[model samples]
Target chain A: MSQWLTLFQKELLEMWRNFKWIWVPITFILLGVQEPLSSHFMPQIINSLGGLPDGAVIKIPPPSAQEVLIKGLSQYTSIGVLIIVLTTMGLLSGERKSGVAAMILVKPVSYESYVTSKWVGAMLLMWGSFLIGYLATWYYTGILFKWVPISDFFASYFYYGLWLTLALTVTISLSAMFLTSGMAGFLSLAIVILMNVVTSSLSNWMEWSPAQITTYANKLLLTGKIPDSLFPSSLLALVCTIIFLLVGIFVFKRKELASS
Target chain B: MITINWGLLAPIIIIQLILLVVALIDLVKIEKTNGPKWLWAIIIIVVNIIGPVLYFVIGRRNH
Candidate 1:
């Protein structure tokens, strides 16, 4: 356990030096703030465009606070996820490439702990930054629009957080398998996008899909009701996350580091 | 042009400026990057939020 903690602390220090600690949260906050501010000033922005006819009346109904919050989430679903994948692309691949993995494994550290420590470190940065950004978005939504109930805020946060966990897990596993960080990052992104697209297209049969986590989160935010499949979907996501972690460990053990 | 609320929008601007500043500092301090350092400096300064993020993500080559 102490060994794992040491490895985890090392992972964090590396992230801090890489500026992941700074850019990730700040980018998320920027995306969060952009959503509400743009929505709040939508009418003014449209008028400023200067393309409308003289005395043209564009009647865009003011979006509800829930809707604005949902929009903020979409920003996360796209740009936020992109940033995350890019930032953590080098998680395992970089270590292996730069010969750091060989040096670490030469010590008394367990392979399982090493992989788990990386996952945990990435998860900490991801979840911490996301929570801070989401709260900022929620606060802006309340001030500019209506206040979202705290219960719904938390409920949606939990579900979305699960989805992000799944994304990070996929990246970690891929990072372990691929030698190149760019390949791992892009392949994981492709899988994530494909999962979302497939689930949406086959929504009738894909009720228990891990990709449904985002849809369920959106539902919770828009309507204060839980989907019946929420538990199953969350369970499946958790299972997948664990499975990916094990796969990462297995691969990391088998593959000889370039340094070795 | 509805009267712009600088007070309400100040935080976003401040956060963006911080991103710009951080990216610039890193660029100056780092020994090597994936591409030309000058190009990164231009992207960081000119490209808004995305520029700095791009510089951080793909610009700096980890040695």
Candidate 2:
């Protein structure tokens, strides 16, 4: 137990040293604020920059507050995931390459403690940042637009978080499996994007797919109701997260952590 | 002087400045990076939200 605590502390300190503790949340806060602020000011912005001829009153229909919040989640799916992938893609591979992993492993550290501590630490960073961003977006949306029902917001938030954690787990596991940070990043990025693309394009065939959580999230916010329950998707994503952690532990045990 | 809606826009500017400053500070303090320090400084300064993020993600030499 104490060993795990020690490893967790090291991970936390490493996060601080890398500036992830500060920048990750800041990034989320910025992303959260950007959506509502831009949506609220879109008309003024276009009028000033649209460069239209005089007297042309282009009456663009204003999007509902629900739409604005949903748009924010979609932004998170893209930019948020990219930032996360880039930030964590090197978590394992980089440590191994830098000889840090070997140094720790040589000193009576078990693979379970090492891998689990990392997963827990990474989870703290992701969830902490996500909550801050989501709350900011929610508050801004309420102030500028309208507040969606709290029940719906919480529901969607849970599902979206599941999807996010699943993606992050995949990233860490891939980094553990791969030899280089670039490969881990590229593979995870491709998978994240590809998952979204496939799920959107073939949603009819995959009613229970995990990507359904993202769609369900948007709808839950927009209509204050979930068109379909997200139980299956949420469960699947949770199971996948657990599997990824296990795989990471196995890989760390079997593979040689480069110490060059 | 043109009137500006500082109320709505000031937050964005403030947030951006904070990110820039923090990124710059980390850059200065870190011993080594993936590339030249000057390049990263320019990137963090020149680019908007993404610049500092890019540096943190790709620039730092974790080893």
Candidate 3:
């Protein structure tokens, strides 16, 4: 127990040293604030482009607060996801590559605790930054647009957070499986992208897919209603996260850490 | 020519500045980066939000 606490603290100290704590949340806040700001200024921005004929009446209807919030969140699916995957991609692979994993494992630390501490530390960083960023976006959306229902906002926040959790877990597990951080990052991203592709192309049958959480989150934002499959889908995602954690621990336990 | 509510936009600008400053400080202080330090400093400054993030992600070699 104490060992896990010490290891977790080390993970956090490492993150602090690398400036992960500083840049990551700043990036999230930046990302969060952009959507509402852009949506709020769309008409003027269009007019300033100056390509239209004289006296052109651009008739873009003002987006609803819900739509603005949803659009803001859409940025997360792309740039936000990429940032998360990039941030987490090196969790295990980098340690192993630098021979730090061997140094740590040589001690009395349990493999499960070591891997779990890393996962927990990464989770803290991701969730903390995400919450700060999401709140920044929410605050901006409220200021520039109508206030969304607090119930709906919280619901969508957890659902989107779960999606991020799943992405981070997959990246960590894959990092455990690979020696090269690049390969781990690439494959984890490919897997996430493939899941979105498959889920979209087969939405009819993918009701229980974790990727559908975003769709469900959008639904909550738009209609403020929970779908029937939300629980099952969330459960499945949770299970997948656990399975990935187990796989990561299993792989880490067996894999050779010293690369040189 | 587009007018922005600076009060509303100031936070985002400040957030970006924080990221830039932190990345620059790290670049200057770190012993060895994955690539040239000057190149990273340029990237951290010139590329807006993504440059600093890229520097953090791939620039500083993990010791």
**Candidate 3: clashing pairs of residues:** none
Cα displacement (angstroms), candidate 2, residue A159, comes to 1.2
DockQ, all models: 0.77, 0.57, 0.81
lDDT tens string, model 1, A105-214? 99988999999999999999999999989999999999899999988988888889899899889999999999899999999999999999999999999999999998
**Taking the tens digit of each residue's C-alpha lDDT, what string does model 2 give over A1-260?**
99999999999998988778888988998887788888888777877786888898888787888888888887777888888888888888988888888889999988999988988898889888988888888888888888877777777678888888988999999999987989999999888788878988998987778877898778767666656657777787888789988998898789987644
The Cα RMSD across the true interface for model 1 is 1.1
lDDT (C-alpha, whole model) for all candidates: 0.90, 0.84, 0.90
Who wins the DockQ comparison?
3
lDDT of 3 by residue, A1-260 (tens): 99999999999998999888998888888887888888888888878887899887778888998998888788787888899899888889989998889999999889999999999999999899988888888888999998987778788888998998999999999999998889999999999999999999999999999999999889878987788888889999999999999999999999987886
Error of 2 at A243 (Å): 1.3
> Rank by DockQ, descending?
3, 1, 2
lDDT of 2 by residue, B1-63 (tens): 234678766876887899899999999998999899999999999999889998988888657
Cα deviation in Å at residue A100, candidate 1?
0.7
Residue A57 of model 1 has an lDDT of 81
How would you class the docking of model 3? high
